[model samples]
Target: MANKLIKQMGLPKSIANIFTARNIITAKDALSHTEFELMELLDVDKEEVTSAMAHVSEVVCPPCQTALLLLEQRVRNETLAGHLPTHLKGLDEALCGGIPFGVLTELVGPAGIGKTQFCLKLSLLASLPASCGGLDGRVIYIDIESKFRSKRLIEIGINSFPEIFLKKGMAQEMAGRILVLRPTSLSEFAESLYQIKVSLLQQQVKLLIIDSMAALVLGEHECGTSRQQALGVHVSFIKSLAEFSRIPVILTNQVRSQFGDESRMYSFQEPLYNKR
Candidate 1:
C-alpha cells in the first residue's frame, strides 16, 4: 500500500521502496519529519528530499493553479484579490487602486514627511466597513517609533469619513479594530511578529503597518553590516506574513543626506534583501 501510494505521487519504484524500507508507509508519515530528517533517514541529497516533499505536499494539500483558473476561482468566491485603496485620489490612481495586497509597500522620506500620518489613515480605512471603501477587517500596527497616537488617528478618521466617525460609539469601535504593538528592541520586534502571525489566524486582519523601520534598527545597533543583516531577517519574515495572510503591509523608512553630496538623499540604511 505504501509503495502504491508513493507511486501514485509520481515517485519511482526505487524511491517508494526506500520509503517503505524506512517505515515511512504513507505520505503523512513522510511529511511528519523535517527535510533534514528525511534526508538522513533515506540517505538522499537535499534536492531529492526537497523534491519528494514537494510531491507529497502537492498531492496532500494542493494550492497551485494556472492564472486563468485562479481568476475563475476568485470570481466564484466573489472576492477579488486586489489592492487596498489609500483614499488619496492622486496616489490611488497612480497605484491603480491603492497599496497592493500580498506585497511590501515602503514609504521612504525624511523626517516630517507625513509617513506616519499616511499609515494612520490607512489603518483607519482598513478598519472601516466595506461600504466606506475599506476592507472591513482589522489592522495590526507595529509601532516601532511609538508614533501611533489614538487621538491623531481619530482626528484623521473624523476628517476623512465624517459620516462614520460622527456616529455614536463609532470612534471607539474603529479604535478597537486596530491593535498596536510597540517593540523597543529587535528581539522584541521579532517575537511580536510571531505573535502577530498567531493573531492573524484568530482575526480578520486586512492590513499591517510598521511605522519607521529605521528607528527600530538604529535604536538597537550601530551603523554597520550587522544592522543590515538583522533588518533583512525581519523584512523577509514580514514579506512572508503579508503573502501568507494575503494582506497589504506598509513599512515606513527614514532618509538621510548623502555623505559627499548633501543635496542628494537616500534611505538611512538599506536592508540586505533590498534590491533598490
Candidate 2:
C-alpha cells in the first residue's frame, strides 16, 4: 500500500527501492519512524526523506475539506458544537455566547483581577453534566503560576451549582475530572502540552486552561529574541492542539503599565511577539 501510494506520488525509483529494502510497506510503517530515522534506514538525504514522509502523511491522513464545507458544518452544528459558555450571564452575553472552541482565548489583566479565579470557574463548569450547560468532559489545567486552588474550585462549584455539587462525592468526582499539571520551566511546559496532545481523546478533554503563558515565557533565562522564538513555537503548538482537538483553550496573561504611561496597561508579554 505504501509502495503504491509512493509510486503514485511520482517519487524517484531510488526512494521507492529504499522503502522496499527497509520493509516500509505500509503508510503506518512509513510514519512510525521519524524523518531522521527514515533517513538513516533508507540511506537517503533529508530532502528525499522529507518528501516521502509528506506523501505518506497526506495519503494516510483524513482528506482535507473546503472552507465552505467547514463553515456549513459549523453553522449546522453551532448549538451543539463550538462554544463553551462560562455560565456568567453578563460575560456570556459580552462574549457573544462563550469562549469559542478551536482558538486561543486569552484573559489578560493585572495580578488581582480574578484571571485564575475565572479559570477555576470555567474548569468546574466544563466538568459538569451537559444538561447544566457544561461540556460534560474533563479539563486540563496547566497551572503555570501555581494559582490553581482545588479548595477554591470546590467552593465556587458548590456555591454556583449547589444542587449538583452538594451531593456526597460529587465534588470529588468533579475535581477528579480536572487534571492539573505544573511545569516549572518552559521546556517542561512544552513537553506537558505534547503529552496532553497524545492523551487528549483518551482523557476526554473538553477544555484546556494554561493559567498565565507570560509566566513561563518571562521566566525563561534566554535573551529576548530567543525567548520570543521559543514562545512562538510553543504558541503555534498550543493553537494546533486546540484546533486538532476542537476544544476551547483559555490562556491567562498578566498586564503591566506601559513604560512611559502609568495610565495605560498592556499585556507585558505582547512585546515579545509584537515589537514596535
* Per-residue lDDT of candidate 1, residues 140-236 (tens digit): 9989878889999999999999999999999999999999998888888889999899888789999999886767787677755777777788888
Give the root-mean-square deviation of each candidate in angstroms. Answer: 8.3, 9.7
lDDT by residue (tens digit), candidate 2, 44-65? 8999889888877776667788
Q: How many backbone clashes does candidate 2 have?
A: 0
Q: Of the candidates shown, which would achieve the greatest lDDT relative to the real structure?
A: 1
Q: Given candidate 2, what's the lDDT at residue 212?
A: 73
Off by over 4 Å in 2: 1-80, 257-276
Model 1: lDDT to the true structure: 0.80
- Which lDDT value does model 2 have at 114? 89
Compute the lDDT of residue 209 as modeled in candidate 2: 92
Residue range with the least summed lDDT across 10 consecutive positions in model 2: 267-276
TM-score of each: 0.67, 0.66
Winning candidate number (TM-score): 1
